[model samples]
Target: MLYHCFLLIASLRSVVAMETCPTTGMPGIPGIPGMPGRDGREGEKGEKGQPGAVLHGGLDLQKGEKGAPGMMGYAGKRGQNGEPGKSGSSGIAGPPGQPGDPGAVGVQLKAAFSVARGTHEFPQKASIIRFTKVITNINDDYDTESGRFRCRVPGAYYFVFHASLGNKLCVLMKLDQTLIASFCDHRYRRQQVTSGGLAVYLSRNQEVWMETKDYRGMRGQQNGHSIFSGFLLHPH
Candidate 1:
């Protein structure tokens, strides 16, 4: 019919282009790089958003209500008494005070004796003697009013003599005039006559005297019994 309908429309367009494109010929020049694609599965969590309400849209800022604590503040006026403290640096002179103890040696005394006033039952000059003083003024002790025997403290001095004479008389003790002690022809108070201690070194003016010999107790009744005492010693 028109060529079998144009040969059945060209054989149904060649079987509908060979069932549409079996290897559509003319498209094959890009094939050398194809093995890489496998990692994409994670995306699901998004729902939370609601908090925004503070909008005081104002224009008069007047906070005025705290004004009652202002009535107790009046006591701060005493600050002018601090200017007298500058005298503290004089303490370094205390190491020179230690020496006081040595004062004890002061003793003095004086005395002398010789009393026999009269009755010369036998007298040969020595009225009644006993005297020995002068050891640097021996600490004296016996001065029946200037009978002599004095030395307040100087050293060595001693004298002792006692005598009676109605039948005896010869005792003496003297210094300066020499002769120290002596007794002879004794016999009184039954018999007692002594005159034998005499050592001198008297000072402090010095003095000592005593005498008695005998005319047999000078005139009578025991002429003048001798007697004398004086002493002082401290130097061996």
Candidate 2:
């Protein structure tokens, strides 16, 4: 009886070993996916995704725009200064500036005058011809009382004069008693007009004026036809 019981127990053990248990975990091997559920009636859209980094791929792959630039990196320490280079040889000196046009000497002397007391003829005596129109008188160098320009600056000057004569007229221009220019008309038959100019070096206080040869010969016309002008050309 004991031997029979032992044999029965052995047989039962063998049968239990041969029998397998149902699998209780994920499938050991991939199984055919079940037909997707009817997508469960479209769910609410998910939150937007964060921006991505700049992509480095074919142009076709870069559908999305480039991402914002990365934050600037921390500044680096300054580098040591480099050694100075050797000085180059001195450059050739420039040609002496063309003497600079005498710098326009600062003397401001200019004047223009016309006969004063119209219709009043001058005397035969070598007298100063006064002027009425004080067109321009700088430094008061020209006198309207006594038609004359007294040189205040020692420099070369230019002078001009105009005279209208009806009868025989003779006008002489004198620079401090020195004859400069003369305008004469011996033809007492017709009217005559004369214009003249001169440039001369004048010393300080030298006077310039005109004198009539004959008072009756040089009669003043109602229309002012006499003028005198002068200006410093250049200072010595």
Candidate 3:
């Protein structure tokens, strides 16, 4: 039995060896070389991918919450800019004003007169003495007494003088030393024989007087009369 087992083992080994070294086909001859390949065209674009698809084996995560809107995106890169605006219109003018009032007047007055004084004479009594008005009085009759008359006030002045005797009379009037009028008669009563008006510009401290051109008491019948008055020559 041992002998048979040995032979059986040898036979199985030989069979395994044969199975390991199996026969192959005969070698074939070399084939001809192939031609050069043509140039290749570009590949077609791939389709758009889904919103959140997995890449390789990685997990497909959802997009995060959108943040606040960015500062308005810097004004959208300005368009083809437009031209500048036109200027505004000018304003209207104002109205004119009203007229003004008239102006005021200036100062004026009388001055002086020589009622009975002589302009030229040699101690002639009861002589014809002329009278006239003077802008500046040069005689001694102009008085600046406290309460009497204002011998200084200026304006036009009027003077009158009359010489009277028992029944004889004579009168004279003057303006600015220029004889203006004279009255003489033998038959006369107490009347304005001489009278005249004068316009003068008498300043302060001037003088005026009156004298007997003819007498009425005895020399030519003796006493004579005289007077002076003042008024404004022009409006102020």
User: Candidate 1, residues 1-236: lDDT per residue as tens digits?
Assistant: 67789989998989998899655568878988988989899889888889875445555565557877778888999999998998999888988887755543433333343344334434446453322222233233444444455455556866665555455555555665667666566555554444456667876655666566553342222433454555555632
Which whole-number lDDT from 0 to 100 does residue 110 have in model 3?
37
Runs of candidate 1 with Cα error greater than 4 angstroms are 1-104, 108-150, 153-161, 164-166, 170-189, 192-203, 213-227, 231-236
> Can you give the lDDT of residue 43 in candidate 3?
94
lDDT score, candidate 2, position 125: 59
The model with the greatest TM-score is 2
Candidate 3 wrong stretches, greater than 4 Å? 1-151, 161-165, 172-181, 189-206, 215-228, 231-236
TM-score of 3: 0.25
User: How high is the CA lDDT of each candidate model?
Assistant: 0.54, 0.70, 0.43
If scored against the real structure, what TM-score would every candidate get? Answer: 0.21, 0.47, 0.25
Q: Which ten residues in a row have the lowest lDDT in candidate 2?
A: 108-117
lDDT tens digits by residue: candidate 2, 74-126: 99999999999999999989887666445354434443333333545654455
Best by lDDT: 2
